[model samples]
Target: MTRFALTVEYDGRPFMGWQRQRHGPSVQQAIEEAAFAVTGEVATVHAAGRTDAGVHGLAMRAHLDVAKPFAAFRLMEALNARLRPAPVAILACNEVADDWHARFSCVGRSYEYRIINRRAPLTFERGLAWHVARPLDAEAMHVAAQRLVGLHDFTTFRSAHCQSASPVKTLDRLAVVRDGERVLVRTAARSFLHHQVRSMVGCLAQVGLGRWSADDVTAALEARDRQRLALNAPPDGLFFVAASY
Candidate 1:
């Protein structure tokens, strides 16, 4: 069998998440179904990271092993044809070394969260962004968020149900910026505990709104308590932007 790596793009609004679920459609199932359409055999596909419901992905990487190899261009064409109506497409495909696992081989992943800070509700971006009716201090949020870049015990930023072996993860980049009305938070790391990025964004928003000082992030990190942090920002604004090997 030969291992094939596929770059996928999807609109996550219409499905459950990346992982297969009993009750709803999933990104994984779509790929499996498409692989069947392409090769006449069902293949198990593993993703670099599993996203939550309502989150979108601009570029997600996954891998599947096939009994026969198809040219990369031909596989992409066939998979996209079968995966339509679910808003998923195979952006690219390439053969990789048999030992290269999509999830475990990834060196880093990046995510972006978008929030609209204004007094009125957005008509065009109903579920595409987080709508807040107050001004956000992007610069303040940027400064406060920077404190999280580096190795730290990030229990405060992890979900209660996070099953990662450890809560210690290094954040390589965290940037908060404003483009017009939306406050954008971009984060990247080698790996993350569940909800880590959203958790950090929630805490940063508190500082952005003057509810917490920048030092509050440090306190929470040192406390190592999940309850010490703020909200876990909504999933709508989050997107799996990219993955690098």
Candidate 2:
């Protein structure tokens, strides 16, 4: 079998998430179906990250093993052709070593959350971003975000259903930026607990709204209790921005 790496993009509005589910469509199942159409074989593909329902991915990476010889670029075109209208696309396909696993080889992962602070329901951004009616304090949010940029046990930000063995993670970066009425939060880590990014965003939003102080965020992190964390942000605003190998 020839091992290959695939760069994928998808609008997470239509499916049940990145992984396959018995009850609904998924990015994995979509890609797998396309792979079967092209290679006449069902091969399990692995992704760099498994996004939750209603979450999008801009540069998700995957690995595929095919027994038949096929050109990388050609495979990309064929797969996209078959996956049309499903809100999923195979961005690129390139040869890789058999030992190179997409999820395991990843060195870092980046996520971005977008929110429209002064939105009138965000008609254009429906299902794409979070819409908030009140303006946010961007300066305070940025300054407060610095407190989370280090190694810490993030149990408070983790979901109870997280499959990761531990909640300890090193937050390499957390940046808050503003673009007119839209606010974006970008974060990176070596690995993350499930729902960690959204959970952090929820807490930061409190700070932005002047409800939660920076000390409150710190206390929540130190508490290591899920109940102490802020309400989990909606998944519509979250996007898997990139994966660094």
> Each model's C-alpha lDDT?
0.91, 0.92
What local lDDT score does residue 67 receive in model 2, on the 0 to 100 scale?
97
What TM-score should be assigned to candidate 1? 0.97
Tens-digit lDDT string for candidate 1 (1-245)? 98989988988888899999999999999889988987998779999999988888889999999898688788889888888878998888999999999999999999999999999998887777888788899999999998999999999999988989999999999999999999999999999899998899999989989998889989998899999988999988898999999
Root mean square deviation (Cα) for candidate 2: 0.8
* Runs with alpha carbons beyond 4 Å of true place in candidate 2: none
Best by lDDT: 2
Could you tell me every candidate's TM-score relative to the true structure? 0.97, 0.98
Clashes of each: 0, 0
Residue pairs of candidate 2 with colliding backbone atoms:
none
Off by over 4 Å in 1: none
